[model samples]
Target chain A: MDVLKGAVDFVQNKTKVEVNQRDIEKILSALNSTNHFWEVIFLSQKPFAVVRETINYLISIDFVKTDESGNLILTEKGKEFISANNIPVVKNYTCSCCEGRGIVFSEIKDAYEKFKEIVKTRPDAIVEYDQGYVTEETAYSRIALMIKKGDLVGKRLIVFGDDDLVSIAAALTKLPKEVIVLEIDKRLVDFINQAAKEHNLNLKAIEYDFRNKLPDDFVKSFDTFTIDPPETIEALDLCFTRTISSLKGAGCAGYFGLTNIEASLSKWYEFQKLLLNKFNAVITDIIENFNHYVNWNYLLPSLESSFAFVNVQPKLNWYTSSMYRIELVKDVDIKNEYINCELYIDKEAILYKEN
Target chain B: MDVLKGAVDFVQNKTKVEVNQRDIEKILSALNSTNHFWEVIFLSQKPFAVVRETINYLISIDFVKTDESGNLILTEKGKEFISANNIPVVKNYTCSCCEGRGIVFSEIKDAYEKFKEIVKTRPDAIVEYDQGYVTEETAYSRIALMIKKGDLVGKRLIVFGDDDLVSIAAALTKLPKEVIVLEIDKRLVDFINQAAKEHNLNLKAIEYDFRNKLPDDFVKSFDTFTIDPPETIEALDLCFTRTISSLKGAGCAGYFGLTNIEASLSKWYEFQKLLLNKFNAVITDIIENFNHYVNWNYLLPSLESSFAFVNVQPKLNWYTSSMYRIELVKDVDIKNEYINCELYIDKEAILYKEN
Candidate 1:
């Protein structure tokens, strides 16, 4: 049954709120249920007299009231009581038609089939390696978590490398004031736009290869940005710099990169340096570490370049697979102390005194 | 080795910050490494090193930076450069420690043993049914998601029912102004308090039975509240009423009740009626018919109560064994529309409503 309509019907019947009879009938029919006497109904071709008893029982307890017009209504006292109390109305026991799965398996199957077909055509797409396409389960759960936390609201955000993850998150999140997407791949940009339409999401997607220049208009406007660029340390570094420039003071960013153990270790250093240099934003938490195959050739040189810039030491290890999430932030100030940068140049020396 | 200290050490080295030789030597000794070079460092023992290197590399290529004194930093030009440029970082290839499975079989066995002990005492206390005790894996993932979403900071919240989930979520959240827990079970309250201390979290666990009157000081103070009452509908109603009274106008509340489909439905109806009568709050989402086990006895009544309240239909269903997270908000007039309470119910209903 259309759960929403069913809810409306239940509210109407319980609260004595006058609603269209046709709407009630439509809802009942959708649920494949037929009303018998006053409150009794049959479901799944089985008569259920208990429903009537329960409704009558509710009336007896003064929880519900019926008007002279035969419209069910909560009593004046009941209404006031419910409002002040902030109570939730029971809508339905279980959606009989869907068995409470929310979506019909057939519909899901069809969507999955379509998703698979689209994936099949893109043999080179990295999504195919990790379950073909993203599921609402993964996307919505992540989005809901964000909303609950307040991260997706009122933050200037940028999406680096438009993909299912970013687009889905953007679509589901409560609209931030501004949402910017940097996409070098035209096909991905078009796909993101189409998906946005389907979801009625407002996101500004720009087609620009991040390896070059960024749009001049985006300087210093963002508060939070996400980086999930192509797998290469150099490219990652480039993306980091551009996004960092557009952030407001104390702004934060997140990145999800694909790297091997050595590369992951190497990129970790680069990520830290970028965070420290740009916003002084600290890495608060690491998200996850999972495995997938993505081309990393382009990122390798950037990784090498980043290695030359800063020195790093390992602390803790956690992983599910090859990929990992590392949290970082701008370095904290310690009194008025300063370190000599030249000390890092002597790689062979274990000890160097500050001059 | 202590993870936090290790991180501090790695950052110190990577940034070329001056640290006493003793401190560096101690850190190295703890990590079981003799070399200053990060690349040759043991993978399992040096996460701080890995993260430092990645950040440093990003900084070196002008992706990130640090000042004369070795403090990790990100440059504004660097931020603009990365996103605008579309840089990518190398992916981690393998699990340095376990090689991929994330945990050694021995660790799994040890965890299993601990789980058995926990289950022997309180079987239902642990979530993720198959897993015995809470694992870092589950905790970290949940916490990470919460952080990304922004649920972790700067909000005033109350948790109704102190349990492992509530306590853990509160602890892992980034930062909040305050966290108040209302628990009926005194033992649970004690447990929560101890756990909070262990985690160094600032959480207050108050012992208050919902069946009794609410403390006057708590009226209309909370911005968000989570309700997870016992399986009894009667108790549920009392708890719901008290919780509502404590919420500020426009505040949201989430409830996770037991499964007595019929009773739940009835209770939901009553609850909604109460909300409408009192705060004019509306139900925004409902998840029923979840894939998890349903405690039919409690769920039925809860479902019934939830249904009879709102005109708007629920968007989601809760049929699974997983706990339900419902969102609701108090309805307010922003543009001065004459939302007549009289139109919905008569003056008699006014008696039951709280101002």
Candidate 2:
């Protein structure tokens, strides 16, 4: 595959768009956003020193043309290249009722409620104390929200940790091409697998540990991955690395749940830096209070004794985590850079950190 | 200033982080997103390659250290550099009820309603048949939505064309550092300037035509600009270039409204390519149906006699346009590239294009 193919297919006799490194970069940048052209030209090292060369390259390739006044126009070839490549353009739309504010997507709300009703009736699954489990509403919304974000359009998806059963909710949509859940808990693995089978969904649960290197077969094999990572910097890094490893390439996306309640602003700052520095990924969307955890009344006893939850259980579970969607902007291969960290953080320390 | 400073600052007797281009890029990249990083990265070209040299340069400068595991960690100097730079991070949290979905941002709704109530009382502004004015609700929401997006936050803003009075509504917030409206319509200029004075809002409207080069003082002087250019490719290109010309630099943003009714997907596709090819801008968001034009009952007589609207008044304002937020990702100077085009289009032909 020619890296500079500019999202064109070569037919036996068709002259392909003569795309160069900058042109390819330009096209990829265009796919990222119809408006982010300035950013693409300025942020990356190409096209500037070679401005004349790049412009000439585009014109020479018959992808673009300049009218008498030098206003750039896309040639039919250029337009065809863009249409054929189907470059993903960043969507500027939100729900009309919600203005993408999401409150008005009551249909989603209803679906979430139904999803929760079903989840409540399911057999009791082992609750991992360290991996905070969200209320069913939040879990269902997480799935619905991912769908809204266009992450599950018949694309292969990998859930790094699915104690939340997003996999089941996603399967309910029957949208993803494949759904694979990697979990350390045998109970969850069995439960999710059972649900997928019962629903006849394109989903599978695999027993996997984050501490081990990601399976070679899984590297760069999926379009998207979702995770609720341990809130510690070390654990967060591990989850990110694993998620990056599983992603197909640039433009591939990952969703993760993070809480300000446990992770302080500094932690957020550090983790954000890590994503950009290591993966060249940018956080595209951050939906706040997107995930509200179910009050894990049973886990109180397992908690660090000093945990103030040691007091009375609040009537309502107010714990909520923000959902983040990070998209890679360039071709980044960090499979070897995947770091291993304890999947479970010290609950007591995290609770204390919250305080 | 050294471009390789790596988000650090100079302190007397303080050891500077030995930062290479990559390290500096890593830090700058971090700063941009935590606050709109993609825009910063796209507008300027850096942090793309030159890896070995960049790394070696960093090591020689001593801004980072590599662990035996080969993990690159920031040194004290590097950390100091990042701290000193204090790059803005992207905000992830939105209103809880709205979930940043925007349903509950009622203050905007209220402001919009109030603006509409007031607008209705004003004498009918001369209806320019070529420039469609949206319904009062659509107009108010445009202003309110801009606020929701943090575009009006104490930043110098330019509205390239404001037949919609978005500048007046934006000024109503009393949040912007400054708001300037440039328009060819003398009626709009006088009306908006009067509104700003009456409201004691920091807004100014000047009678300026798009056909002329942007004022020299205004070049790269504003943080953001908004326009609703004519649907034709020629007009869209002119408005975009003028908007780019007015932007301060990378990380600045622009907003425009385009409709599927008048602009076909082909037009959309061509215009998008032009944005990337000419301006290097990236579209961050496109909120659909955000602008509903107030039906111009008066323009029926002036519209092409073939226009069916010539027969009967449509009760509903059927025209809706998507609002797009395009941010500069890199440093871009389009002062020279700004083009001029006829701002008006043949209504009948545009409607025919839609079919």
Question: What is candidate 2's lDDT per residue for A1-355, written digit by digit as tens?
Answer: 1524423222101221122332344334342342222232322213221222343445667766655433455677766665554433322333344334343334445545556655765544343536557766566556655554445655689998777888887777666788999988887888888877776888899998887788888998997889988776788878887889888765567887776445533345456667765776755555545566765654445544432212334344445666777766555776554455555543213333222
Q: What share of the reference contacts is kept in model 1?
A: 0.00
Candidate 2 residue-wise lDDT at B123: 39
What are the per-residue Cα lDDT tens digits for candidate 1 across A1-355? 2432444455445433223222232223322221222221212111111222233434555645455443445556545544453332212333233222222222123333443334333323432211112333333323332332223444566777655445545544434655778876666777766656665666667786655556666766665666544333454555556666665432234434332222222234344444444434433222222222223222223223221111111111211112222222332222211212221112111111112
DockQ values per model: 0.01, 0.05
Q: What do the candidate models score in CA lDDT, each in turn?
A: 0.38, 0.57
Best by lDDT: 2
Please name the candidate that would achieve the greatest DockQ relative to the true structure. Answer: 2
User: Positional deviation of A64 in candidate 1, in angstroms?
Assistant: 76
Residue-by-residue lDDT tens digits, candidate 1, B207-311? 975555666767777656665443333454455566667666442444343332212222333444444434444332232211122122232232232212111
* Model 1 quality (TM-score): 0.29
Stretch of 10 with least lDDT, candidate 2 chain B? B10-19
Residue ranges of candidate 2 with Cα displaced over 4 Å = A1-100, A103-105, A108-111, A117-164, A173-189, A198-355, B1-114, B121-129, B148-150, B197-200, B262-282, B298-318, B342-349, B352-355
DockQ of 1: 0.01
